[model samples]
Target: MKRSSRKQLQNRRAIWMSIIVLTGMVWSLYKLSASLTLASASLPLTELAVSPGKNHAAPQNGTSRYKILIDPGHGGKDPGAAGASGKQEKAYTLALSKKVFDQLRQDPVFEVVMTRTDDTFVELEGRAQIANELDADAFISIHGNTYKDPDVSGTETFYYADDSFVLAQKVHEQLVKSTGFKDRGVKKEGWKVLRDSKHPAVFLEVGYLTNRNNETDMLSEAHQIRTAQAIANGIKNYFARF
Candidate 1:
C-alpha cells in the first residue's frame, strides 16, 4: 500500500476509536446520573423509616410526665352531626381522638388511656368515672361542635366550673397557634365529663361539624394529626412551666 493511503486509513481508525470512547463516556455519565437521582428519591422514605422524628424533634415528655385520660365524645346511638356529604361527626371525633391518643402515647411523660376505642356508646358519666377511678392527671374530652348556622365556624374550648381554666386556655391557644383557626376563646361550661372528673379536665370543640368547609378540613388526616400534635404540645408546654 502507498504510505499516504496507509496513513489515511490509520487516521480513520483512530477517529472511529475516539467516537466509540466518547459514546461510552456519555453512556456512563447517564447511568451515574440516573443512579444518583434514584438514591435521592429514596432518601426521604429511608430516613422516615429509620427514625421518624429525626427530621423533627420528638415531644419533650412523651408518655411519662403525667397521666392523660382521653375521652372520645359521642358514639354508637348518638351520631353527633351529619355533614353535607353524609360524614358523621361522631365518627370524625372518634378518629381525631384516637389520633390525639396515639400522639400522646409517644411521649414518656404520659400514661394515656381512652374511654372508648371503638364505635360503641360510652355514657357521659361513665367517661368521668373512668378518669376518677384512674386518678388521672388530666382529662381531655374530644368533640366536634355543631351550629345551625354554617357561618358559625371556629374552635372553642371549655372547662368545667373553674379549676380547669388554665388547661383550657393553654390547649385552646396552642390549637389556634398551630392551626391558624379562628380563636373562639376558652369559656366555662358544665359538662358531665369535666364536672365529675377529679382531674383537671377540658372539653375541646375542635371545629364546627355543621359547616361544610370546616367539616372538610376536619376530615383530613393531616389536619387531625396536626390538631392532635398541637394538643399534645399544649400539654407538654403546660407541664414544662412546672
Candidate 2:
C-alpha cells in the first residue's frame, strides 16, 4: 500500500476511536444523571421537608383534624349555681365536661383538650387563653344555670362572636333534644370565656339547677352521658362545614 494511503487509513481509525470514546463518556454521564434523579425521587418527601410545628396530623384526604377545647364552668372555689339536692355546679360541670371529652376523644377527627380535668380553679379568661394559645378550632364551656324563679328550666346556649352563632345553635339543638328540656334557644352574650376566645366558642347552660326536675336529670349519670353524646355530635356536625 502507498504510505499516504496507509496514513489516511490510520487517521480514519483514530477519528472513529475518538468518536466512540466521546460517545461512551456522554452515555455514562447521562446514566449517572438519570440515576441521581431516580434516587432523589425515591427519597421520602417528609424526610426532606421541614415540619410545620406541633399541630395535629391531617387525615388521608389532606384535611386537618379539628382541635376542640372543652371548659368545665366554675371550678374549685367557684361552685357556680346550687342544685335543689345541694349538688354544686362545679361537680356537675366537671362530670358532664369529662363525658363530652371522652366521647370526642374516641373520634379520630377530633383532638380534644380540657381546661380543667379536675375541680381546679381555671379563671374564665384563662380558659379562653388556653384555647387561643393552642389555636383550638372551637371552645365549649359547660355550665348549669340559675334564676330567681326556680321554675325557669330549659337548655340555653350562648355565643359572643358572630361566627360562633352556628356552633351555639348546633350544640343547643342537640342539647335540648337530649335533655328533653324546653329549648331556650341560642343567645349572644359577652361572657368572659366566649368574649376572650379567638376561636368559635359556645357556652352551654345545660339546664337550670334551680329547677327540681332539671337538677334531678342533670345529676343523673345516664342523662349526663346522653347530653355528652349530643354535644359531641354537634361538634362533629359543625366541623363538617370545613
lDDT at position 105, candidate 1:
88
**Model 2 per-residue lDDT at 61:** 38
Cα lDDT tens digits for candidate 1, 1-242: 99999999999999999999999999999999999999999998887676532211233344335778888888999887787568887898789889888898887777789988989998888999998887777789888888778888888999985657777888898888765668898989887777898778999988888887778888988898899999988877765544
Candidate 2 lDDT over residue span 42-63, tens digit each: 6766553644322222232355
Per candidate, the number of residue pairs that clash is 13, 0
Q: What RMSD, rounded to one decimal, does every model reach? A: 13.1, 11.2
- Using lDDT, give the best candidate's number: 2
Q: What's model 1's lDDT at 96?
A: 87
Candidate 1 runs further than 4 Å off: 1-65
Clash tally for model 2: 0
Best TM-score goes to which candidate? 2
